[model samples]
Target: MKKILVVFLVIFAGAVQAQEVLQAGFKLLENGQFAEGAAFFKHYLTTQDATNKTALLCYGRGTGLSGNVTEAKEVFGKLLQRYPGDFEISLNAAEALMWCKEYAEAKRYYEKLLTEKPNDFAANLGYANALASLFEYEKALVFTEKALQIQPSNDNAKLSRKYARLGLADYFVKNQDYHRAAPLLESILSENATDKEALFAKAQLYIQLERYNEAEKIYQQLLQLTHGQTEVYLNLSYLSFLQANKPLAFEYANKAVESTATQPQKYLTARLGRITALGWNGKFKQAFAELDSLDSVFPNNNDLLIKRAGLSIWNKEFAHSVSLFKKSLRNVPSSFDGNLGVADALFAQELDDESKKYVLKTLEYYPNQKDAKDFLAKLALRHAPALTTHNFISSDKGGNASKNYQANVAFDVATALRFNVGYRRREVSNSLENNSANVQTMTAGLRWRVKPFWLITGAINVTKLEKDGAVAPFKTFDIASEFRLNKFQTLELRHNSDVQSFTAGLVGNQLSFKNYIATYNLSTPFKVGVYSQYYYTKNSDGNTRNLLFASLYYDLKATPVVKFGINYQRMTFEKRMSRVYFSPFLFRSYEVFGVSENLNVPKQKFLYQVSVAGGMQRIEDEAYQATYRASLTLGYKPSANIELTAYSLYSNSATSSVVGYSYSETGIKAKWILLKKQQY
Candidate 1:
């Protein structure tokens, strides 16, 4: 009995020594001296029993925490095999799987362990982390709460719960459920107001919502964080860009590029932001230079490819843009930027069907994506049926007045082909007897885009005229072809046979004209443009007219486009008939004009333009007379498919056989989409 007691005492002493060694190792691990803890446990294992379950668990954790995850996983896996169903060993094994990034397997193992021990804190927390790693954030959150309920004061469990909440919020943001995302982020901020990840996420959510000012505020808060200065500045630059403050954008981007942040991926992103900001500022050469330099360093990188593609689009290099976007798609076939970039590039090139294909593909990859749906709606508008009405009344100093009303229905009958029909009514009256006329007209038209850059259109008009109780029916037609040489150049040629109805006298005479016109326009990248027009007319009274006009303009701004221009006009008539309409032996005019317009009427709720010009005109060798013209148009779009506009114009330039003439007209117009959606 004495010998047995001594043996048992010896075993007890050895076990106590082993427990002390384990406590020391755990102390090292708790202090984050993982490498030292690993060495301590390893030394203990070398001389002691190698299979002490608690010692093995601590060693595996230390090894994994010290960055030897593969070896740690192997060790824990062997320990699990040797001690099957041992809860601590099983939990360590699962954690090792996570350390090795075997998240799915770890999740499965944790699930099994939880089924066996539903209330085990370690298993619940480990499974929560594994699920979070797998981006199963909602489930991860559930398990995180479970772990928290088990150990309400466990800081590790609390941290895991925090990160799970973050992950779930990010998932919601990615899916565009901003309302759901916002509350979660706010919850995290409520817990720790300076949490960098939560702040950044909230800023991005505001950006997605286009609450730019709020996003700017968040970014400003982020600027106080030391760890991600470059990222903060990069986002600030992007936000500036979104706000249409190009100079501020460039300034922020430059700061981002010059920041001392050393993270490689972040540095790369800052450079890209600088390049994009440069592009926004119209510094294309510098942007391209920077892009090329970066491309040489990171060849075929998807983000670089996308940036280059965007620059290509900005430079009007559509084909090259498409090619670069395709290269990005080849790298990541489901890349949202690649698919959407290709769609936009194709749309810029007027390849609508091709653009639609990629847009649909984008939607396929990201269901219910708002940008894709909006783009699809814009595309649909182009192919949908539409109706329009225009009404105007005019009066001249010669005691002549007229009223005109017109309506049209138009639709794209097929890809690149359109058909339209219209009707018009006009009434003219003057002081002289037998100088009153009324006319009714019907019209049909067709337009076909034979190529992306070329289009042909033709219209036929049937008119019934009545003057002094006499009625005359006549048919007239017009045909035109337009060529878009490039983004900034266009040419149009047109010929028309029409009744001359500028005045009551002309309408009473039933005068007709055959007119041929050519127009060419060229816009430069420097915001300068030249527009020229030439006209030749043959009158039914055996008279001919020739006219030439040209304008040179400079754009002062892009949004709410403002332009100032100088215009010149020269004209001659083969024969002058004073009693008739505008038929001068010689006419010349020069003017300087300024105009401000919001040209994106279809995309916005409000549109407007104001134009004014003052100049001098000479007719038939008379001394030059001061001339002035002004026009204003305002439009309101109540919905996506409807628009209402009102306009007024007044001109004192010579427009009649008399040397000086003045005219004014005012009108209201309405346009509506006939269908709520496109046929396709």
Candidate 2:
């Protein structure tokens, strides 16, 4: 009996020591030292009873939390087989399903567990987490609330709830249901004021709603919360981009790149942001260099390809842009940037038909996408029929006056062809000469695009002229062609045969002339431009003339575009006809001009242009005379399809058939689109 007591004490002490070790392992796990707890349990189970249930359970959980999910599942599997129907074992086994990423199976098991024990906090929280993992955010949110009700202060349950709300809000935002998404995010921030995900969602939603100021405030808040992190800086850059502040966008993007020195995933995203900002600021060389560096690190990435494609477009490399976008499409067939980018590049190349195909394809992947819809609308406008009318009256310093009325209708008969018709009526009078004339003309024209970059336009005109109680009818024709040499260069050749009718003396004399003109223009990305025109005229009165006009200009400001320029003109006649007209042996003029206009200002309802020029002109080797010219136009677009404009101009640059002529004209014009939507 004494020997039995000794063995009992020895066995009891050994059991107590094992219990202490198990408690120590459990305490480590409870303290969230997952790897340490897992190592402790691993060594304890090797020499101890392998069937120790409590120790095995703690071991499984510790291993799972320590990222050894596969081994955790194996341990839990054996435990469930050994102790079937034990609720604690069953719960841990179900949780092991989640750790193994078998979310669907875990969801089913948790649902069963919930039905058996509705109030069990662990089961409720586990089910919620499984639902969240499956992206069933609505159900996850419901179960998360249930878990919270059971254990109101459970931190894990609250965190699960926060993420579930984030997922739901993102879903709503994806569907453009801002009203529903806003409140969900606001609720999260209301509780946890510094929730990063919620703040980002809120800022993005604000951007979508075009509340840029609010979005900016949110970004500033995130910047403070993150303490100048890469992600917040990148988002701030995006927000600035949306506001059309390219400089600010580039500044923030630089900050984002500087915030991280390592090549992590976030760093990759930050680099992309910097590339985009550089592109926006027209720094293509730097953008391309950055892109190349990034590609060496992460080859064939869709994001990089998209950025490269965009930079190619900006650099006017349309074919390269198309190729790059196609590469991106090969990677992500449904990528919005790929489809829309191809559409834009093709459009830039003047392949409108092919462009329309990609535009429709973009809509196929993203229905009701605003940018795609807007592009379609713009295409429709190009194909739609339009009508415009101009009316003006003028009096010159030479006692010559005129009133003119013109109306034109243009319709796109085909993708590359447009048909146009116009009518004009003019009445001219000279008080000093005691002469008057009335001229009426009807014109029909066709503009054919011979190639994507070349166009040919021809027109025939029938005119009836009545001057000094005599009426004469005649016919005229014009043919012109234009070549878009490249993005920065253009050339045009034009020939027209018409009767001169601008002045009463010319109308009375019935002067007819044929004019041939060659025009060339060069535009530089540096905001400078050069335009030159050469004109050759043959007259029925057995006289010929040659003229040259050129202008060099620079854009001082882009928005409300302000420009300053110098103009030079020289003209010579084969035979002087000072008696019949103001035909001079030689004429020359030089001028300095300034122009300010807001016609290109986007979303501007009121448009205007104000131009003024002053110069000196010489006639027939005579002394130079001072000349002045000015023009103003104010326009209003009450609707998308209708525009009204009032304009006035005055120039003393010898623009009439009389010598030293000072000319002025004022007019109101109206343009109307027959339909906003294309019929065909």
Say which candidate scores most in TM-score.
1
Q: For candidate 2, lDDT tens digit of each residue in 1-680? A: 00000000001245547687577776677677888988888888888867777778777888888889899899988988888887777788888788778889999998898889999888888888888888898998898899899989977788888888888888777777889999889999999888888888889899888899998998899888888889889888988877777899999999998888743558888888899898878788888998989899898789989989988998888888999999899999999999999999988866778888999999899876767877787676666889999999988877789899999999987888899999999999889988889999999999898786898999999999998689989899999999989878999999999998877788877889999999999988788999999999999999999999999999877776899999999999999987777778899989999999988675568989999999899887689899889999999987667889999998878843355577778999999887644432
Where does model 2 exceed 4 Å of error?
1-185, 209-214, 238-246, 262-265, 290-302, 427-438, 466-474, 504-510, 577-582, 638-642, 656-660, 673-680
lDDT of 1 by residue, 1-680 (tens): 00000000001345547587577877787788888988998988888868776677777878888889898888878886888777777777777777778889989999999999999888788888888888888888898799889989977777887788888887787777889999888988998999888899899999998899999998998888755489898889889977768899999998888884565557788899999998888788999999889888988678998999999899888889999999999999999989999999988877888899999999999987878988888787777889999999988888878899999999887867899999999998886444788989999999998887889999999988888788888899999999988878999999999986766667777888899999999998788999999999998999999999999999987766889999999999999876676778999999999999984733578879899999999988789999999999999987777889999999999853232469889999999986564443
lDDT at residue 405 of model 2 (Cα atoms): 96
In model 2, the clashing pairs are none
Best by lDDT: 2
* Candidate 2, residue 367: how far the Cα is off, in Å: 3.8
TM-score of each: 0.89, 0.80
The RMSD of every model to the true structure, in order and in angstroms, is: 6.7, 8.1
